[model samples]
Target: MQTESVKLPRLITPLIDALTNVVVIENGAIVKNTLSETALTITNDMPQSLIDSLFQSDNPVVQHNQKAAEAAYTFKITANRTLEAPINLFIIQKDRNMSQNLTFIVGEHAGVTVNEYIYGNDGSTVDYVSQAVVEAAGKLDYHGIVNLDAASISSINRMVSVKQDGKAFIKTAQMGNGNTQQDTRIDLLGPLAIGEIKTVALSSAKQEVLIRSIIEHKAKHTEGLIEQYGVAADESFLMFEGVGKIHKGMSKSIAKQHNKGVVLGEKARLDANPLLLIDEYDVEAGHGAAIGQIDEEQLYYLMSRGLSEKDAQRLIINGYLHPLEKLLENDIVKKHIESLLENKTA
Candidate 1:
């Protein structure tokens, strides 16, 4: 267990006061942790060149986050090792904006799980970026939850690359009653690599939420999946854009995307776009998007069973968000989601 505080430099500080807070990092028996002020600390025996290359990314948002980052936290797992327990990362925002970077490296045949929680007060601004690399035959499971107060704004960016025979699973829940934007990209750079991404979001009270995700398959026999679910009410707006791409010559690759939204208010708005781009032969690719309100027939059926209209709606919402709970698999995350659902229904 280790805790450290990081303060932003004056050059990046705007009208808001300097942001300083403590970050907690816990390393399991199989995983190693490193903390630094300017860059990610690597304790593995990997060459410095390889470690430096992980910091370089082609995504514009990732580059911007790296340039603006004032602090960094890194974790690495050695080859042929599996962590017995999940690693927990905690961040709490106070008076000013937050800009930080996180890096994860998994060695060959290694496996690890990371859970991240981020919370902030009203009117706060947060910028977070995460980069991960999984070596051949490695696996990574990541879950993140963001719950910001009303009127706050947050932007999250993430990029992940998986080598041959590697697998990556990512699940994110955004229950903020404010403006939020999330951008994520996953690249399968080697044969037999697999990636899965799932996201659930809720927006209400004139809030706005935007989610963008891309999965690129660059090698043969690669597979990818993307799923997005959102709910909007009280004149709020939500949009999801997902793309699956298979590069040329990447035969036997499979990519799929699905996006769905439910609008609970007459004034609320929802938009979903799922796209697939393929440039190779013998590849499988598909996408679908659906945006609509709750089913009237289902609501009436519940009401006929002696349940009030509000209770029926709440029941429907609970069922809609229940799938996300399976991906979270944490007591704290479940409690947070329950609280958010209660507030939204009330």
Candidate 2:
């Protein structure tokens, strides 16, 4: 932490998003964080190279409760002095050599929205994690989408620990052509804490997705919901591993696991595993998973009404993506999600 660089509002420089403006912060205090209605972007974007420079410089731009695995990432962000408005950060990879390690700190009564997208031009496989430590009464909402074209691999190692009355929500949407893989993990740490996770993956033609989530309740009145849905076309495969458990003295813990998959090819494969580790009574926890093909009768009914089989398949696949689509509130992101699903239709 330096006296000069610490004067800025945000630690990382605004690089990629030229529309971004400067924020002001000083020694554990938020000087100012506001943008005019006409402003296009309140948050800044920087190139991966520049972001890497700041991390190496190690001169704190703003107070950040952060850490990372060495030599692989570009940005680090801390709440600009006990943040007021929810902070949003974006991580992107354009070159195949790109990789990142990021950490976040959510102060009490403060919240943040971290959005991450992993992509590559010549096919990149990156291992990274966006770890957050949520203090008492704090909240963290995270949204991640991976658009890995053929020959890309990605993993999201995320952990959110809540206080007695705090909550953490994670949502993911993944789609890829060619061959791709993704790994995810989450846990609920405090009593009366809440953890909710939802994910959807679309694979087409020799592509693969391995999805996993673990929910461990450490205190009483903790609640967890894990939902995973995947769709495959043209010989794609999806493997799911889900675990939910309630340790002793964790009364009234509720964990539900469900996965519904649609496979539409002679060679396509779907492997579903749902596991529950219950150690005591007075808890409600269970798992549900199903893998199947689209109904021919439904397609026939639509075809009878003058719709082609191809279009009928589109409707069925769209239906599979609808539940998660309704969950996104942002327009730009929601439309992008629809586009991903649309690409898999044919």
Estimate TM-scores for all models.
Answer: 0.83, 0.73
lDDT of 2 by residue, 1-346 (tens): 1234322222123321322222332221223444332312332222344224322322231112123333232222233323333333334333343334454546666565555544333355555555455666667676666665566566545555566666777777776554544444445667778887777878877777777776778789888888888787778888877788889888899988988888888888888888889887999988898788887788899999999888888887776765455344555556666676777756
lDDT of each: 0.74, 0.60
Name the candidate that leads on TM-score: 1
Model 2, which residues run further than 4 Å from truth?
1-88, 178-180, 296-307
Question: For candidate 1, what is the lDDT?
Answer: 0.74
Candidate 1 residue-wise lDDT, 218-303, digit = tens: 89999999999888888988899999999999999999998877898799988998889899979888888878888889899999
Model 1 TM: 0.83
RMSD of each: 7.2, 9.8
